[model samples]
Target: MKFLVLCLIALIHQSASQSPQASCQFENSIDYTCVLTLTNPNGLNNITEIEVNHMPNRTNDDVVIVRTSIFSTSRNIPSIICDTFRNLRSIDMFRTGLTKIDEDSVSNCKLLELMTVRFNQIADIHPNAFAENAELRTVQLDANNLTSVPENLFENNKKLVEINLSQNGLAVLPKKLLSGLSELRGLFLTHNQISEIYEDTFADATNITSLGLGNNSLTYLPDKIFSSLYNLLDVYLQNNQLMKFNPYWFQNAKSLRALYLSNNGITYFPEDSFVNFYKLRELMLDRNPIQKLPGKIFASLGELTWLDLENCQLVYLDPSLFLSTYNLWMLKLANNDIYELPGGVFGSLKYLATLDMTNNQLQAISSTSFYFHPDLRTVRFGQNQINAVDEKFLDVVNVTQLNMEQNVCADGFWNDDSETKELFRTELRVCFENYIEPPQYCPIGNEYERICELEAQTASLTLENAGIRRDLEGLAARIEQLERLISSSP
Candidate 1:
């Protein structure tokens, strides 16, 4: 009888020792609530049976926030874990190898307000997965393999302020997916396969401020898709296949500030494309195939401060292209076919600070290329065929940083410093000794001709004044000689 009892006790001890274990530690106190962090370092497939050690002064009920990390093979969040933390307010699980979110996985945590299950292999989430978490305010499920989500997925979470579904395989958003998320402030759907958005998709998201839809396969957008988002501010649509830009997309989003449309197939823009975006501050149109821009295209964007047009295949720029964007602070025109900068092309950008014209075919940096902008600080002209730099180039624009590398000028001429003026003079006498001004493609308008005439008249007047001074000096010498002769005779 004693030997049988001993065998039974040994069997029980061995079975308990082999069970997977998850350790819990007390984190810093947040809002006077004890926060507990549970970690499974043994690649445990089951964490529900693990015992949790509460803080010295707190019990399981006293914990409000629970974070789980480093779980290598947990397929789903066990309901028993959330059931134990009935008063939980937040749960964060990252890179846990979770493949799916089962319905009511966290339904026991009634007070849950924030949930983050990012960087996991989660491909599907049950439509009612978060149905019971009515108070949920933020949900971040980015970097997952989710291709689609149900339309009513977030219907119960009315107070949701932000949702980040970026870096996923989502191809399309259901028409009513965000139907009642009136309190939504930010929605990030970048790096997905989204191709189309219904016109009423954002009709109820009137209060949304920032929308990110970059790096997608969207080739077209409905004209009135964003007609209801009046408070929209920043929009990111870069790296998409958008063939054209529609002004009606932002017809009602007057509060827009930043607009990004780089790496698209857009070839041109109508003159009134940005007429409704009066308050827009930043505009990025780089990496397009646009060969030319219409004059007065930016006439209404007086408040625009940043403009990017890099790699647009622009062979020429209209002289009055930027006639109204006076507040522009940065302009990027790099990696194009521009052979010359039309005179007064940047005359209206009085606040222009940084100008990038690198990797172009510009043959010369003329004196009138850059108009006087007091804040001009950086100018890049590298990788061009520039053999002639006007002696007055630096005098017109006082750029503190100038990049002229890989040009025809001597190495010493690329130096940009207080002595740059003297270096430029020396380079002109040596490298550009036989330089001839390139023929202007744009006609020298009446204003330019009138200025040239004025300059010629001034030069002729200066020569006449010098000759008069020499004659006056000779007459004074003769008069003094005569006076000395008269005095000697007396």
Candidate 2:
């Protein structure tokens, strides 16, 4: 019995000396080893989340995986970090040249919880790539070249919180994809070719916070899309070919905060497009082909602050549109064939600060076009055939760049003589030099002031022209830096 005890001690010593290859996800020096006895590698891509930068490095004496994939690399790229711990928690193989990984290849890493395989040219993934490791939290497969997903992909992953498979080639998601993932938080499928969504998409996620399906080809949504998701906050549906919208689309998502539906073929938006999203803050409808909007299109969104309507086919618009939201800030109507701004266009938006009417055809600007109580800041008239601009087009706020360079401005709008232009020049010079982030001011204060100041200052300014330094490609780096500094300062 004494001889047997000595032999067992020798065996244990030998096993502890042979250190396995490990990865450190944090900035610590602690070492870790594969805790194989406690780990079950039967789950699909069994990953132990080691949030790098987001989560401080774990410094336990036992080996721990450091989470640092996103801060270090993009899709499918591999990197190495020194480790002192005996256990690894997260493995990021995202965008690296890895084609496959299964339980056999990763049998040595017994404590992995998360794996990032995004944007790789991977065509196949084994079903049992990961097993019953419970400490995993996230698996991101965004922008990958995946053709399909295997069954029981996340079978025994109890701690997995988020699964990002967006921007893939998923035609229709499998029903049992997330059956075992009960605590998932986010489901991202933006920029995919998913033409339809069945009720099974939300089967496993009870605490989903955000669902991104922005650039899909879906014509309509089924009723059960948000059946299991009670905590959803945002839904992105931009760049889809949606022709008609129904109020029942988002009837269940009552806690939504933002909705994006820009750049689609939506000709008309139903008044109930925002029926259930009571907490919505921002609504984007830019670059759509919508020729008209429902009289109360934004009636349901009481907290709507910004409404983007650029590049839409809005030949005609109602003047008294904004009646519900009292906190409206910005309204964009650029790149449309708007012939005139109705006198009561901004009658409802009493708190509007910025109005971007850029690249639109307008014959004239009247003082009554704007109803802001000195709250308006910047207004763009660039890329437009604006025939005239008077003092009514702007205000004296912070900074303003009324881009009417090509527009036909009547001559002698500033002063009959050049001496009065000096006073205007001082005001614009002081305003721009002292103001913080590019501000908006009265068109009279912005345009005439800039023209006079630059005209006077241009005569005294002298420096090496950038056109003269194009002789050598070798010295472009240093020359570029010099050019930037000179251009940025006054």
Candidate 3:
């Protein structure tokens, strides 16, 4: 029989020359992606996949990449590209341990777009797995250990845009959990242990725009909970134990722009809290124990520019408070318990630059305190109890780094007085003339030389008492001219 047809052509050329394995390549045989890099026992333990049904440049819309080399060991995520690449588009299983993912595990890949089980340990995921994937857009179950998420898991991925369950342990988020992901745009539940977040929780992810609930344990947030995210932009509630923050849940976040409530135990804040954030520009209420605030609370953020009230133990500040932050530039009231700053507080900040009242209890600062519009720069009154510095304080703007460290100067004041040390040396460079204490020393060894020896003996006793009154007026004018010439001596 022709030697059994040459022994079946030598067994199909030894199964197409031992099926691609020199660190398999051909990354794209014209959209038919292929990249099987397995090497550690060559194709690790005699290959667990890549049947490629007699590969001779496989095609059926081929897309296969079974990478495994980093001293490979944790394998089992290969359903052989869902049973030999039936037009599969993507499947990247990196650092595998994919503990669970049933429902035919990506059966009929249906042109899968991208499914990355990143740095895995993936804990169960069978709600029809990907419910027969409808061209999934992107799903990277980041650093997984996922707790629960089977409510129609991704409800038939509506062209799902992005989903990275960041460092998961997710506690609760199962109400229509991202219902029909309406084109979700970046939703990463940062380091979750999520504590309450319902109001139909993002009701179908209304075009979420960057929401990473930072280190979650969130305390409360359910009123209109982001009012359907109206194209929301930037929301990362840092750390978290959120105490209160319901400004009617952003009254329809008018395109919110950068808002990260740092740390958190947030002590209330609803004086029209950012009135629809009118395109807010960087606002992070630092730390938070927020002591008080209601003077038209930021007067409607008119495009506020970077304002992080550091520490927030704010004492007083309502002189038309921040007068609509007129383009404020970098203002962080560092570690506050602020004592006083009321008169037109920062008088409409007209482009004010870097003013961090470092560690406060400020005693005085009013020469129309920071008035008029003039791009002033860097003024951090370090650790304050400021004992007087109003020699026309900041004389109408133009400062260049003045930190007034740990103040309390008053005798011969601020540098042995050269007219109050040239009034803070023409707007500052006084570079730390130390003193948080030591100043009441009055043993007068030299009080400016005893005040210049009492003003030079009172000006030499006023010229010796005017020469004894001009010698008694010249002896009464020669005794009245000898008594009028001896009474006319006739």
Candidate 4:
């Protein structure tokens, strides 16, 4: 009778521990055979880690879970499996086979800060996976196969900083999924299948510096997609299906220095596509179907130093293409159908160090091609139509390899701008009393009210003067002063 009474006690405990109503759906329905029987090894008060099947019968809400470590080498954790622990700090069940996450269990792990469950079988996580977990700042799921992310994913965890969901199977990123994580800085969504994002997806990430969205199916982007990433410095948009480019796509990316847009379907970007990206340092545009490059293609890419334009059908370009790119250091225009190159095409590159024109149809080069370079290091005019060679050619400052293997031209033409461009620098700096930055064509930079104010003042003053716009002397004078001030600024 004593033995029978003990068995009855065990049966009662097991039933109470295992009878939670299933709210989250699983991939398959399987009968649970887990019977919990927990015994604190160092007494009932000092234990740390416990097996999921050994959750002793208890109703206390203050069980301080130090380490809820799984026993097996496998790392997948069940959604509602840690029902025994109350105040867990860190859970490391990564690479496990977790399927569904019980949203209610989030309140149990109130102090959880770090969670690792990558390479798991979790295809769907509850939208409120971190609803009540306020202290969870880092969550890593680098190799998961999640297909969709739902809204309210981090609705209330306003302190989250780093989230790594890269190398996943995502298709479309949900709206406002990161709505409450306003303090997050670093986000890595590389190597996924994400294709859609509303304009406000990055609305709250004002402090984000680096964002990687490479290797995806993104075909289009809104004008204000990076508006909230004001402090962004590095951005990767490679390996996508972008058909066209827009100048306003990066309106607020004022601080971006490095941009990668290689391996896309862009045929020919507008010459002004990068006009606003003034401080850009490196640009990578390899392996695209770019057929026509505008004469003033690199007009405003003033800060570009390293440029890669390989694997494209670049045939014709204006001799004054690199006029504004005066600080270029390395240029790679190889692997294309480049039939002609003006002798002085790279004339403005005062700091040019290396030039790689390999596998191109280069015919000839003249002394004026690279006239004023004091630091040129290497030149590759190889694999082209080379026949005639000037005795005075290859006498550059520091050119190492004079690759005249395949080129047939008497001498490349030099349409050099003999007029010194730096002479106008002094004329624009003349003293003006009320000098201001000139109004630009950008909607935000130049408002309609400013135009109205100038028009009204000019009309009133010109009534006593003459009809010519120049006769509206004060108005024209102010605009000229503002233009000069804007031009002289850094």
Model 3 TM-score is 0.31
Instruction: Tell me how candidate 4 scores on lDDT.
Output: 0.61
Report the lDDT tens digits of candidate 2 across residue range 174-233. Answer: 767877677887778887887777777676777878878888888877766676677878
lDDT of 4 by residue, 146-201 (tens): 88777778877788887888888888877786675678878888899989878888
Candidate 2: TM-score? 0.66
**lDDT by residue for model 1 (1-490), tens:** 9999999999999767655555556664763243333343333446575466666677778777767745434667767667777888888788777778888688888889989899988888999999999899999999999999989999889899999999999999988989789999999999999999898999888899999999999999988898899999999999999999888888788889999999999998887889888899999999999999987688788899999999999999887788778889999999999998876677557688999999999887775555355567788888888887765456556566767778776443144466345655665554355455545433354223333333323322222222222232222343443344344442
Give the higher-TM-score candidate: 2 or 4: 2
Give Cα-based local distance difference scores for all models.
0.77, 0.57, 0.67, 0.61
What are the per-residue Cα lDDT tens digits for candidate 3 across 231-264? 8889888888888888887678788889898878
Which candidate ranks first by lDDT, i.e. highest?
A: 1
Model 1, runs deviating above 4 Å: 1-21, 32-50, 71-73, 410-415, 424-490
Better of 2 and 3 by TM-score: 2
Better of 1 and 2 by lDDT: 1
Task: Give TM-scores for every candidate, taking all chains together and pairing residue i with residue i.
Answer: 0.83, 0.66, 0.31, 0.64
